[model samples]
Target: MKILALNGSPRMKASSTYHILAPFLAGMKAAGAEVELIHIRRLNLEVCIGCYTCWARTPGVCIHDDSMADVLQKFNTADMVIFGTPLYHFSMSGIMKTFIDRLLPRFEPWLIPHPHVPGVTGHPERVQKPYKMFLVSPGGFPEFEHFDSLVATFKQMARMENWEYTGEILRPGAEPLSRRSLQNLFTGYYTLLRQAGEELIRDGRISDNLQLQLREDLFPGGKEVFYQLAEGYWTEQMDKFKVPQEQRHTVPLLAKDLDSTPMAPAGSNITNDTSKTGDRYYVSNEVIMQTMTAMYDTKAAPNLQATIQFQIIPPKIDFDPGEAMWYLEINGARCDLHQGKTAIPTLSITTPYEVWYDIGIGNVDALEAFTNGDYEATGSQKLLNDMLHLFPRPEPGSDDPLAAELDTLMMGMPTAFNPEAAKGTNAVIQFILSGKGGGLYFLNIAEGKCTVQRGAAKNPTMTIHCPAETWLAISTGKLDGHQAFMQEKYRVSGDMAILLKFNTMFDTHTN
Candidate 1:
C-alpha cells in the first residue's frame, strides 16, 4: 500500500503533531506499507484564489504554477492519505485549510446526490479511485471535546470526496510529549499509535478498544495537574525571554539578557505559602498531611508494604495544638493516611514542624536536612531512604545532571535497592574505585536492607575493583554492566553468585 502524509504544522519537525505522526508512519512502514511524508511549511504553495480556472477553463488542472501540482499527483496515486495538523481555534490550522482548498481541482464543478447519505448533495470526484482518509492532530487544550469540530469537518470532507473515513488519532494536552523528562510517561501512548498504524494497514481498521485507549491522557495526572505544569512552563519561558509583566502577551523584541537576568532554576521556587490582601498564610499541618497522602506513587513501589509515622513537633508560629502525629500505611501499592500514629511503624520520623514544612515545600533538600540532623529517623533505615522513591518529589529541573560522583552514587544505593529481590539475603560488597572522584565504599546488605559506608570490609562476600569512571558509566547506563564485566573493565572477586544478582538486586541505572 502507498501512503501520503501531509504535515501542516508551522513548527515543522518540532511540532507536537509531528511527534505523533512520525511514530505512526514508522509503524506503517514496519508493516510493509510504502509511506511518503510532505511538510506543508516547506512547500511553495499559494492560497486558492477561487478563480474556477481548474473547473471552468481547464478540467482537473489548477492554474497556479506551484508545488500543489506535485502534491496532487502524489495524492491521486496513494492508497491512503493522512492529514497531520495542530489544532488552531477549534479547527485545523490555517495552513491546513489552505492546503485543503487547493485540492478543489480534484473535484468536478457539478453537484450530485450523496452516494451513501440521504438528502445530502456534494461535489462528485473528478477521478474515480478508492482510498482511505485519516486525520492526525494534537491540541494544546486538555479536553478531547476541543477536537469535535475538526473531526466533523474531516468526516464531511471524506463523504464529499468518496473516500473511506478511517478513524482519527487525537491527542489532547500534547505539549508534555515534547518534554524530555516527561517522555517516559508517554511511552505507552506512542506504542499505541504504532499499533494503530499497523492495525490500519493489516486489519483495515483500529480496534474499538485500542481507539479508546488512544484517547486517554498521556500521563496519569488529571487536567488540573496538566494546567499547573503548563503554566509553570510558560512562566519560565516568559522569564527566560525577559518579557515585561505588562507586555506578557506580546513577544519580546530582544534575545534573553543572560548576564543581567537572574532566573530561578526549575523546581526550585515551589512553596506552600499563599498571600491574600497582603496577608501571608502558611500551610497548615492538615494540608501538608493531605498533600502527602495524595502524592503517593503506587507504580514506583508496587510490592512495598510498610508503615511510616510522622511526629511533628511544635512550631514557632501560632498553630492550633502546635504539634501533630500522623501515620501512613502502605500495602502493595495502596497507601492510607491516619491522624494518629500506628502501633508499630516500619519507619518513624521526628522533626520540628518548621523543618518538615521546609522540606515539603522544596525550600530545603530532604537528604541534606536529614544528614544535618534536622530530622530524626528511627526503625528501619532502609525505609527512611526509600521514602523519596516511594513518593517521589516533582521532577527536578531539566538541567540536572544525569550522573554523579562515586560518593553520591554510592550513598543513593538504598533508594534504588529492590527489597523484594534481596529477600533473606545477607552479604557485604566492597568497591575500591580508582581515579578522580573515586573512593573506597562498601555496601552491607542484610535482612532485605542495604546500607553504604566509606571503608574497606573485612571478609567481604564480593569485592569489585575498577576505575571510577567505568563504574559511573555502568551505573548510569552509559555502558552495559555485563559487557563491561566481560571486557574486564571491572574485576570481581569471590561470591560469583552475588555478582550475578547485581542487576536484580539494585536498580542503579535509575539513579
Candidate 2:
C-alpha cells in the first residue's frame, strides 16, 4: 500500500513535528508498505494564482505550475494522506495553512442544491470514499483543542473535496521532543501508516489493532479526545488493543475506562538532575525512578530486545547509611539481592536510540545538555553527573545509510557480560568491588543488564578493591578512578600504558 506523508513544517524534517513522525514512518516501511514522506519545506510552493485552468484544462489538477502539483498527485494517489505540522500560534503553521489554501482550487463550484445541517447551508450530498484526511500536530500537553483548531480548516478542505475524515491524530508532548521520543513517535506513526496502506489495498479496512496500539503507545492522552462528546462517543480509541472478533469494535463504541489515568499530564514539569554529587535535588535517585514510573506512557511501551548498563564506580555516592535503601521486588521474591542492600539504583535507559541522537551544531555535552537547556532537569542533576555521560558526536565516515540511522550497533563492553579485561594499550577493564566476589556490574555508558561478579580476575591489569558502596564515587570522578591506584584499593601492573589508555576510554564514556 502506498502511504504519502506530507511533512508541512516550514523547517521540513528538521521541525519537531517531523522528528516525531520519522519513526512511525520507518515502522510502516519495516512492515512492508510503500511510504513516502515529502517535506513541504523543500518544495518551492507558490500561492495560488487564482487561475481556474484546473477546471477548464484539467479538473482536480492545479495548473499554476508549482510543486503542489506533485504533492497533489501524491495526495490523490495514496491510500492515506498524512498531514503533519506543528501548532505555531494556536493554528497550523503558515507552511501548512498556505498549502491547504491552494488546494481550494481542487474544489469546483458544482452547485448542488442540498439541505444543510442544523445551522449550516449548501452541504455536499454525500462524502466520497478513499480520500481520507490524516492530520498530525504536536503540543506540550494532553489538551490540544486550542492548538488543534486546524481541524476546522482541514474539515473545510475535506468538505469541498467530498472526502471522509480518516481522522486527525494529535501528538502530545511534542514540543521539546527528545531524541528517544522522536524515534518512538516515528516508529509508531509509520507503523500505522503502513498498516493503513495494506488495509486499503488488500482488506479495504485499516487494521484496528495497529491503530489502537499506536494511539495508546504514542498518544497516551488520546482518551481526552472525547471529553466533549455527547453520551457515548467517549469510547475506547477504537479498542485496537482489545483482541477477539467480538471485542474488536473500533474506538467509536468503546466507553472510557474511568480507572485509566493519562500520563504527560497537562502542565506537568519534568526535571532530571545530571549532576553527580551532594547536589542531588531529588532523593538518592530513587525518587527519580518513581517519577519515571509515574510519567510512564504505556502507549509508547518499550520492548527490551537490547540492553545497556551503567556501573557506578565508587566513593562517588554522597548518601549516608540513614537514607533507607529503596525496597525493590526482584525475581519473584524479596531482598537478598546485593550485599549491603544498597545496590546503587542502576538505570538501564532505552529510548528510540542511544545517547547520541542530537546531531550537528545544536548538540551539547552531557553537563551542558542539562545546564544549557538541552534537557528538562527538575532535580537530581548530580545523579546525572554521578552516572554515565555522553561522548562527543563521532565524525561521520563513509556514505552509509545505517550510519545515518540510529546507533543500532553496540558502543562498548556489556556491563552484564563482563569480559576479561585484556591489557590493551593504556587501559585495563576494571570493576569497583561492591563485595569481594558475587554481584552485578555495569558498564560506564549504561548499557544495561544484570550479571554476577564483584571483582576482577586475578592478574587482571588493574584491580580496584574499594568497598561495594564506592562504585558511585569511582564512576562519578569524585573518588577519582585513579584513586584506587594510590590507596592500593586499585592495583596496576603488567601494562601501565595500556591501562592508562583504557581509563581514557571511560573518560569519553561515562560510568
What shift in Å separates residue 254 of candidate 1 from its native position after superposition? 11
lDDT of all predictions? 0.75, 0.44
- Write down the worst ten-residue block by lDDT for model 1: 251-260
Compared with the true structure, model 2 gives a TM-score of 0.36
What would the per-residue lDDT of candidate 2 be over residues 1-511, giving only the tens digit for each residue?
6888888777665566776567656655665668898887788888777776665567667777788877776766787677888877777888777787676555554555533333444433222346766677776554556654677877776665556666665665454353443455455555565565455445544566755654543434354532332123224434433445542221221122111122222343323223433332223233222221221222221221111122111122444322222222121111111222222122222111111122111122444443443333221233344322111122222243332221111122333222233222322333333221212121232132312222122223443323333444454455766655565444333446645555434342222
Error of 1 at 394 (Å): 62
lDDT by residue for model 1 (308-391), tens: 788887655554433389888777667778777565556678766666654553345676667766777766666666777665
TM per candidate comes to: 0.48, 0.36
- Report the Cα lDDT for residue 319, model 1: 47
Point out where model 2 deviates above 4 Å.
51-53, 56-63, 114-129, 178-511
User: How much is 481 displaced in model 1, in angstroms?
Assistant: 86
The regions of model 1 sitting more than 4 angstroms off are: 243-511
